[model samples]
Target: MKKKIGLYFGTFNPIHVGHLIIANHMVEFSDLEEVWFVVTPHNPFKKKSTLLDDYHRYDMVYEATKEYPKLKPSNIEFKLPQPNYTINTLVHLEEKYPNKYDFALIMGRDNLKSLHKWKNYEVILENYSIYVYPRITEVENIAVLKNHPKIVEVDAPIMEISSTFIRKQIKAGKNIKPLLPLTVWEYLDKMNFYR
Candidate 1:
């Protein structure tokens, strides 16, 4: 049987507890055998100025997930062309891993609402399953997708915690240690990041 893997793509500027919670919940409660944190080098919609170096962000994800057997850090997007889309990564992963892995997308409710705007979104919907976690956001215009057969809503906790908020707290010299895993926090502190 192919290993079931869920792709949790993000910048992971400084991976924190909220991310762990969601990823863990997905693996524990769903059919996914493992959750891979696919760190993106560049996201088409996000600005580059605020993003830390790709390696540093990847390192943080590595540190954060090292303790969890089912959680992993993947820098596959780093070697791909800039402004990589989810479809491109999904395709690449399928080819690279061959028939060894069944890949699915792990996303939040907010992203679900905007899935229609993604590149080749229809293709994605037809080819892969999506596991969505709840988010406290104004969801709109996703009725068509909400009932899609491939989309599964996981009863995971609503994690409003964001990397941006953690960054701000670090910049303000506030104690943000509790938000991150110990190894991740140590790496960020040692590098003096976000300040």
Candidate 2:
């Protein structure tokens, strides 16, 4: 049987409990063998000034996932071309892994609203599956995604926490241990990051 790997693509400025909860829930309930945290170097929608260095974000994900064997960290975007598009990454994964594994893009319902604006999104809709978890957003725009064979709604909790919030907390010198993993918090402190 081909291994089903769900690609949880994100910048992961700092890997936190919410991310772990969602990934773990998806792996157990969504028939995914593993969920890889694909650290995006630069997201088109995000401002670069607010984002951390790509390697720093990647290493944080790496350390945070050490205890969860089913959770893997991937810096695949670093090797790819600039302005890493989801379609391009998926196509490359298809070529690299071939019949060995099957990949599904895991995202939030929030992303579904902007799916149409992405590069070659039509191809992604037709070729691969998408797993979407609920988020506090208007979903009327994604009507086409509703009940689609290739689209699965993940029954996972929607954590309101975000990287922006975490970064702000760190800058304020507020204790954020309850928000993230211990290893990730310690790693951030060691690097003297955000403050």
Maximum-TM-score candidate: 1
Instruction: Report how far off residue 8 is in candidate 1 (Å).
Output: 0.1
Cα lDDT of candidate 2 equals: 0.89
How many residue pairs clash in each candidate at the backbone level?
Answer: 0, 0
Q: Once model 2 is optimally superposed onto the true structure by TM-score, how far is the C-alpha of residue 50 displaced, in angstroms?
A: 1.7
Write candidate 2's Cα lDDT for 47-145 as tens digits.
Answer: 888788999999899888999999999998899988889988998898888899988999998888889899998899898889988876637746787
Tens digit of lDDT per residue, candidate 1, span 70-145? 9999999998888899999999999999999999999988898678889999999999999989888847738788
User: Lowest summed lDDT over 10 consecutive residues: which window, candidate 2?
Assistant: 136-145
C-alpha lDDT of all candidate models, in order: 0.93, 0.89
Which candidate number maximizes lDDT?
Answer: 1
Models 1 onward score TM values of: 0.98, 0.96
